[model samples]
Target: MPVRSPYPDVEIPEISLFDFLFTDFGGRDAEPALIDGGSGASISFAELRGMVEKIAAALAERGIAKGDVVGIFAPNTPYYAAVFHGILRANAIVTSANSLYSPGELAHQLTDSGAKLLFTVSPFLDRAAAAAEQAGLPADSIIVLDAAEGYTSLHDLWGTTAATPAQDTLPTDTAVLPYSSGTTGLAKGVILTHRNLVANLLQIQQMGTVTGDTRILAVLPFFHIYGMTVMMNQGLHANATVITMPKFDLPEFLRIIADHRIQRVYIAPPVAVALAKHPIVDQYDLSCIDIIFSGAAPLDAELGHAMGKRLGCTVLQGYGMTELSPVSHCMPDDRPDLDLNSSGFALPNIVCKLVDPETGEEVGPGGRGELWVKGPNVMVGYLNNPEATAITLDDEGYLHTGDVAEVTEDGVFSIVDRVKELIKYKGYQVPPAELEALLLTNPKIADAAVIGVRDDEGEEVPKAFVVLQDGVELSADDVMAFVAERIAPHKKVRVVEFIDVIPKSASGKILRKDLRAREAAKA
Candidate 1:
């Protein structure tokens, strides 16, 4: 009836996030835990543990308590681990905000999550303050990771008396609230409990090999679930030295890999494309890299093989979503005989089923269907949105992943397509509904439909089909600029076309398939 993981189940500890990651430093405390890629600055494991305790005390002194929500709106930095663990140490939930979000976008998440405190950096203070004001958070609630004129610095929290260990929290309590557009629609918070995160960490550990000597390069944004669980938490749990890059820059990425002698890299398909085709890759020596693991989007097998061949490493892929605590399946480092095109087998303790979307019958091996998964790694629910949660997580506890996939007789899974309408731009979720709503705000646009179309780079981008008002003229550049001003850079509409009518179903739903066919014809 269901396909099970090939590996044995892992033993997940019933502990807080802080205890799980920071408690067992062992003899590696003096070693570097995190390193800043740009300046080569580092934080030792012992120092990081101390900082988490002290910051937890500071947050408690500021009236933050168990069940309170705190926001981190900064990029990947050496101090990020300290701040993130400190929030958990204080027994508060951490809601990571996208650093690239516009003030309005940031305000929505802060307001929706009911965050009382926001931890940010110097460059983002102005926007953070704006968002804080909009969310009704006081100026004093803003703490700058880097010291600023009026804001509190992380160092200022160090001398305070450390707070006692986190109170006994049930493993079922929510630990992180990273938002995602589950199947289709606007973004909603995905409630991942402590157990959900811990289970995923343990599951991934069982599926792959990561030891104390592993050196990982973290270029993926930590705000996304993929980076948070796979790179940040798992790296720490495995006692690896993680090198953080604030953003992706090809030359800088190459330099960091060479300089750090990074042994493993976690990436998405777009980055894999760049590594495979970019001419500058030959300039650096990447022989130290042992594994290149790709996730967040489907990667072309040829591209993965090409990159692996060029870098002299093993290329692998995994598949999951924000609602599944981000990862349910991954390619094992030891499984060199598996197909590179497949996303790999389920992680230990995970149960996956494929059911025909139209007939609602279970699909056997070699047949395709929408994938449904049941595991400890699945999310608790969407925060404050029970209806959406009900639609996603069935009464039987299986999560509808909204992905069409096929399973092999040996339990390997391969994603074929998405049943939902969410567009992924370089691993970032861009909802078509969000873009359609924004397009309606333009004066000249009468009706519009947004769909993802691939560009020359093989990356998905939001393409808008607009029906302008009768006798009104608007340039495509003007339409693009209008969306750019209202949304984040990744959500911007990169392609536009003027059409007279938008195909719709009898139920008044946009026929996205028709639009996709039109785009395919043009291509």
Candidate 2:
């Protein structure tokens, strides 16, 4: 028997995401819905809705329509939200690419998702243009949110005399396509439908409190499912103000929380390290913060406790993945007393099972096993990859989350380790296969395998186990620099060790567990 959520199930309404989020403002039309923390500019609820309508009309004028996939490859900003909803309001699908993606990386998503157009900021125009050309999208399809030399601007997208397009999307229609590595391999688009997103919003609502008075901080990139659903959409669903930061900077993050009087902050474990131990954190007054919620990776209880004690706020943690629409378990607002090490209880409408991977038997409370989740918030499937989809989601409607977990009889779940080969670096997914493939491209390297290992600070970083070609010389930094130049910063090879051979199975699969054992022995 599967363990169910402790909380009452939430009613997931049958509606499109646009209608679900934008249909009501509840008389706070004049209140700020989104604030740009860097520039201090804001967009009120009324203004944002108006912007959405005009942008949608402009997109329709440019031939975007139902079933069309549009890409948003920009950072967190009030305009990012506007364009995101505008794509949906235009009855088009959104494939949000990571803001840190290199041109090649962005092109992969664009080609894979079949995106017709891409929305980006002026600062990212160079990369956007390169990716667009590589993906076979015309230059005219690149729209800059702000000023650019010759590209279409958001200003151009506005002031359309044409009416906004009618909403043709159904609850079951695909909405946003955020790519994830899932259990392993290269990034694949996670097919989250309108209902999947809406269901997650409602399910999260039953687990936590986010009133209109709450001010959520969004420093994590909006491309990741954690920030997309929990920080961006959840803030909108509650009609609360959300403060946006394009990237994480310690002093800047501290200042934004103090200056904005932000009540809630959603961060990964790494940020907690900065908040707890960084000397600059003491200079800022963070007394206004009410809750500091951590996700994406496991949070150390001691670190969480230290951060909360320092800031005089409650520290909480949750467990999720891209395939579960990102959240199936979290600590409730009222249950701060639950072990900070645990992910608290399963969220409403989530049914969880722990199964022994070796024996194919269900494991109860005290036993460790892989977690399986079934819920309304689960994704439909991976886009255009039925084989990968079948491997992740089983016939029983459960998503076979590759993370190993343990649960108590009371329904509390704690993610202890990952069964997948992907490494979590500062909350970003770094797929080993992607890195291994990149390493093989180097002429001096004969073979390579990448795995996660703890650095001095205890954060996970990708370490390359390499075999060099005979008579060739390459330093550790040389290997790191080669990979850093070719991939996004997060996927950079941090540590490198030249070895004679990388352990492999008979079928030619890199035995990651053997590499992990070697790492353990070294430690």
Candidate 3:
């Protein structure tokens, strides 16, 4: 049995996420806000606030009005946070694109959301420019966010423009339009309102897991919502310093904690696997880490507990989807003897129930059923797709998560599987349908099925089991390169194995779980 909190139900607070960004610290000006763990570039709270205002004013000067869509296409940087708040402060929508996305992969998001402006870094300039051209966005609309030396700098926007007064951003106004595939389909833009983001932030805080005094190591990419909302937003709201990384390097990750005396770390299952098995993780001093929260993928309980023993920190797991402002449940650090497999109970103010997918009736406690979540954190719906939105949200407003999960008697929940055709690579959701559509464009491929296979990193990567047409000679490397060329780096097919036919049900739905099992057995 999982530990239960005896604290009575409390009324969930109604607040805007932007309010915390501007008003929380009461002018704590000189404190460190974001520090790059690699390069050691630090931004104080005063400078951060000033940059946000300048960026906001710059966008407004460009005629980007409320409800407009702005694309943020950069890795984790101080400029990234400033641009994000700038767009949201204008009551506009932010479409975050993974920096590793291929030109075509990025073009899809830019076109689908009808984004008017793009803020991107220099290393990605060529790819971003190609994506913009392919998406038909004009050249003037492309804003390069090159803060490093020898490039067009974001600082150029500051002092040239007066900081605009913060606009009236309401709770119902959509702030971030993060893309996610709902219940196994093409990736659709999820309409996350200010209320949705703020609600989940408050819910996670109420779990009594983290605090203002906690120092968080932020390695997860801020382009993704799990890191953006849970790690970055929550850390700043609590007045904690965010030590960020451009990419994951195990030794450097360890040293950041040692140097900064970091107490809290936010990660996904892949990081846990690294900490548990990676030999280099033992090379650094991690004596100061007090808590580790893993989310975005299923974590191995044995490995998590082992981490606790090795690092002397309480490691807990959280569960959520991109649709639920990315955090529906979290297990706190101080909790006693948490179950290794369960994702903990819903936090205060969240409503979760398991229902039969076909019948729509609530399942008994401890029975596996499709997970239905309802709360202020739930998104308004899929943007501009009425059918997908209708199928996802029930008439009574419960968002059908399409996850098969079972709840314990005391409300701890564990996800068995998602009843959709999406694969989680690290923490990013890769839609098989999108990959399948892309694979068909290859001249040598007659048919293809994308499935998740565990790699050496202990994280799942996309593997394409393909059926080559007669007289087509395609090597595994050739097929892999074909995918790498067409899709994002994370969505690239890591392994290519020739198959006669992709196993499918009578209705022609690809049986990916069976494919995953085959890979596991072979391993």
User: Tens digits of per-residue lDDT for model 2 on 1-523?
Assistant: 6999978888888999989998897778899999999999999999999999999999999999999999999999999999999999999999999999999999999999999999999889889999999999999999998888888899888978988998899999999999999999999999999999999999999878898999999999888888889998999999999999999989899999999999999999989999999889899999999999999999999999999999999999998988888899999988999999999988889898998988989999988999999999899999999999999999999999998999988888998888788899988999999999999999999999999999999899999999999999999999999999989999999999998999999999999899899999987
TM-score list, all predictions: 0.98, 0.99, 0.93
Off by over 4 Å in 1: none
Location of the lowest summed lDDT over 10 successive residues in candidate 1: 161-170
Q: What does the lDDT read for residue 286 in candidate 1?
A: 90
The segments of candidate 3 whose C-alpha lies over 4 angstroms from its true place after superposition are 1-15, 147-152, 163-166, 455-458, 503-508, 511-523
For candidate 1, the per-residue lDDT at 462 reads 95
TM-score of 3: 0.93
What Cα-based lDDT does every candidate model obtain? 0.91, 0.93, 0.81
Candidate with the larger TM-score of 2 and 3: 2
Pick by TM-score: 1 or 2, better one: 2
Clashing residue pairs in candidate 1 are none
What is the per-residue lDDT of model 3 for residues 1-523, given as tens digits with 9 covering 90 to 100? 2222333445544555667566767455688888888777888877887787787777787788888999988988766888888787776889998888888778989999999988898888889889999999987777777654443356666645555745777778888988888777887899998888877777777775565567788888888888889778887777778888878888888888899889888888878877887788778889898888889888889889988888888888888888999888777666747796778878766677788777867786767788888778898999889999999897877788888998877777888877766788877888888888888898889989988777775677788889998998999999888778777777778887889999999999888878878887987
> Which has the higher lDDT value, candidate number 1 or candidate number 2?
2
Shift in Å, residue 78, candidate 3: 1.8
- Model 1 TM-score, all chains together: 0.98
Model number with the top TM-score: 2
Model 1: per-residue lDDT, tens digit, 1-523? 7998988888888887777888787679999999999999999999898888889888988888889999999999989889988888888999999989989999999999999999999999988999999999999989988889988888788868756555656788889999898889988999999999999999999877888899999999888898899998988999999999999999999999999999999998889988998999999989999999999999889899999988989999999999998999888999856788899999998999998889989998999999999999999889999999999999999999999999998899999988889998988899999999999988899999999998887789999999999998899999999999988899999999999999999998999999999988876
